[model samples]
Target: MDELFKGIADPLRREVLELLRKAPLNINQINDHFGHISRQAVSKHLQLLEDTGWIRIYQAGRERYGYLSKSAFYAFKDWVDAYLQWGAHSIDNDHGVFLDDTAYKKGMPLTQPVMLQALLSKDKTFDGVFYTAVKTTGIFCKPSCSANPRPDNVIFYDNKDDALKNGYRACKRCKP
Candidate 1:
C-alpha cells in the first residue's frame, strides 16, 4: 500500500504507469509521448515506480522496456472486487466470461516474429527460442519453433537470453 501510494503520488509517474499498461515501452518511447520532459526525468520516474513495486522492467535487446506489475493489478482487482460487485452481463448470446480481444492483443506473441528454424529442429529443448539477424524484424520465434524444412523467416536461438539479446520475440501464431 505504501508503494502503491508512492507510485501514484506524482502525476507524471501515474501517467507513465497508464501508458505502459497498454504495451511495453523503452524510456525513449515513453518520453516521446510527452513534451517538455527530458529523458532523464522520465528515467528517474520509471526507477521510482520500479522501486515502489508498481512496475517491472525487462531487457529487450540493448533497450529496457517497462511494463505494469502483475502484483499491482491483482491487488487493485482485489480491492475493486471487495468494494464493488458488478452484475453479470452477456453479449452476443454468450456470458460475459468471454476473453477481451483488445487486452489479448497487447501480449507479446501478437507482435513477435515467427521463427521458422526453431520450429523445424528435432530437439525438444531448443523449442523456446528463435533468432534471425538478416530479417526485416531482425529476430523472430515461436514457443514451439522446432519443426523441419525451416521457413524463410527463421533463425533459432538456443535460449531466451540469446534471442532477447539479439532482439527477438515469441511469435504470434505459436507464441514462445
Candidate 2:
C-alpha cells in the first residue's frame, strides 16, 4: 500500500500513468501531451514509475514506448481481499492494521537465464518470460527460447549481472 500510494503521489508520474493506461506512447508523445514539462523530466517520472512497478516500457525500433503496469494493483487487490475476509473471523478491526506479506513471500523471482537453462536442460519449453540487459539489442527473447534464433555472435547471459555487464536491457513485457 505504501508503495502504490507513494508512486501515485507524484503529480507527473500520476499523469504519465494515466496517459499510459490508455495506450502505449513514445517519450515524445508523452512530452507533447504535457507541454509544461521537458521530455527529460517526463522520462525521469516514467523511470520512477517503472522503478516502482507502476509502469512499463517497450522498445520499438529506436524508441522506447511506455504503458501502465497493473500487476502491482492486482497484488494490492489480492492483499486487501484476503485481509478483509480473514479479519471477518479475527479480532474486530477498529484499531488494528495488518501487514500484507503474500506478494513478498512468493520467493525470489528467477532470472531469465536461470529459468531458460532449467527449461532447456529438462527439454521443456514455455513461451513467455524473458530477460535482457541494456547491452543487447534485437535479442529480446523468451526463457523457453521459442523465438526465432539469433546468431551465435549474440552472447548468452547466464544471469542478470552477465546481461547487465554487457549493457542489455530487460524486456518490458512479461515483467522481466
Per-model TM-score on C-alpha atoms: 0.45, 0.44
lDDT of 2 by residue, 1-176 (tens): 77777777888887787788788999889989989877788777778788888888889999989887789779778878886764343233222433223322224565444443433332122233333222235444344343323333344454655565665655555333
**lDDT of model 1 at position 67:** 89
Q: Give the per-residue lDDT of model 1 (tens digit) for 24-105.
A: 8887789898778888888899899999888988998899888889998688677666433321111322222223233223
Instruction: Name the runs in model 2 displaced over 4 angstroms.
Output: 80-176
lDDT of 1 at 13: 93
- Alpha carbon lDDT at 157, candidate 1: 56
Worst 10 residues of 1 by lDDT: 87-96
